[model samples]
Target: MVDNNWLAPVWTLFQQQPLAQGIGLAAMLVGISAFRQRDDGRFRLRLCLYQGAIAFHFLLMGASTAALSAGLSCVRTVASGHTRSPWVMAFFLLLVWGLGIPGINSPVQWLPIIGTTIGTWGLFRAKGIVLRLSMLAGGLCWTSHNILIGSIGGSLIELSFLFVNCHTMYRMWRQPLPNPS
Candidate 1:
């Protein structure tokens, strides 16, 4: 467990940046919008918008790790829509690990790194139920990470995402597959 003291300064910093937090909230809303899109292409496009907003929010709040990961996520999300090849998926996973290495200085940092890794792999390779399930795993990691970073909006976003995404997944499962011609 991380020391509690680490959060005090972070909390103070967050309190000072309401605008950044607001942007994060907006990002979360945008992300929820993405979940409503049943089409793969539409989903990826909305995710790109969410990632961009989140990147900016993290940048303003001085959370370089999450910010960079979000930026990379934007790229990864877009690329995944164009290609679902195993090679491309491997490259994305490697990229997450490569970038994570330099940024990881302590155990706490690992939360986002792990989350991003899971998210990158899932977002890039998985489809249908597997994709959402993978993202749920990633969202859990991010929940811990956002809390550690004192990101109020980020925390709410992940928690809400998990709930909403799960509900969406359930709905998808309930729907019958279309009959083949």
Candidate 2:
């Protein structure tokens, strides 16, 4: 936990970054809309936009790791539907981790790294319950990271996403499975 004495300064710094806050709010809005998408294809498509907003938000806030993770998420979400090839997924995973190495100043940085890895795998490779469950796990990690970084909007987005994603997954579960060929 951060010392109480330091928090006031940090809060003040956060307050000064109006553009960052605005971008964060925009990211949150886009993310909420993305979560509302019932179809996986549409969800991933919308996520590309959300990730772009979030990446810029983090960049403006000078959170390099988080920004990189969000940027890679855009790439992952955009490429996920194109191929189910393990080779491609593996390449991106390696690239994300490689990019993250230069930015690791503290243990907290690992949160987004691990979280984004799970998200990339789930978004690119998994389907149905597996994808939803992995996303839930990733969301929890991101929520913690966002809180630690004092990203009010990012934290809110993850929390809201957790609830909405879970509800959507439950709806998916309750529906009858489609007839197989």
Candidate 3:
């Protein structure tokens, strides 16, 4: 018989935390919807909601670092909608690093911190396709973290986000760019 126990841990996680998995599924749906929005403001609004939901999902899954990062992401997404101020961006970056550094037990823990950092910079400095590209990079980090942590829903969310984001980017690319005034 071939040793095929690789899925056991993920199966155990799903069985042990059905509620968390449910929330993760919901978060995944919201995140997919967020990326589908062509309007930047609407996209940010939906992303904020998705972040908050994912934060709760992480909390229930006992991923404290991921939870904190997602919570901060919720706030940062909302704040990013209001201003692109470098000072504000700098503050959030510092906050993520300052709070996240103490909790680092392994290199894997760095994933969410780095993901959030990329996302924060993208929100503050980029818009349209560039922002989505940055988010794509961040999603890769989160996807790896999710798989390592045995979070089936988190893994699904990031993978789905990557596909949806790419489609949205393609849609944006097909449209003619606004003439620079």
Per-residue lDDT, model 3, residue 71, is: 95
What residue runs in model 1 are displaced by over 4 Å at the alpha carbon?
A: 1-14, 177-181
Instruction: Rank the candidate models, highest lDDT first.
Output: 3, 2, 1
Model 2, 75: alpha-carbon shift in Å? 0.8
The count of residue-pair clashes in candidate 1 stands at: 0
Q: Identify the leading candidate in terms of TM-score.
A: 3
lDDT of each: 0.82, 0.86, 0.93
- Give me candidate 2's TM-score against the actual structure: 0.88
> What TM-score does prediction 1 earn?
0.87
Candidate 2's C-alpha runs over 4 A off are 1-14, 176-181
List candidate 3 segments past 4 Å from native.
Answer: 1-10, 176-181
lDDT of 2 at 120: 85
Worst 10 residues of 1 by lDDT: 171-180
Sort the candidates on TM-score, descending order. 3, 2, 1
Q: Report the error of model 3 at residue 71, Å.
A: 0.3
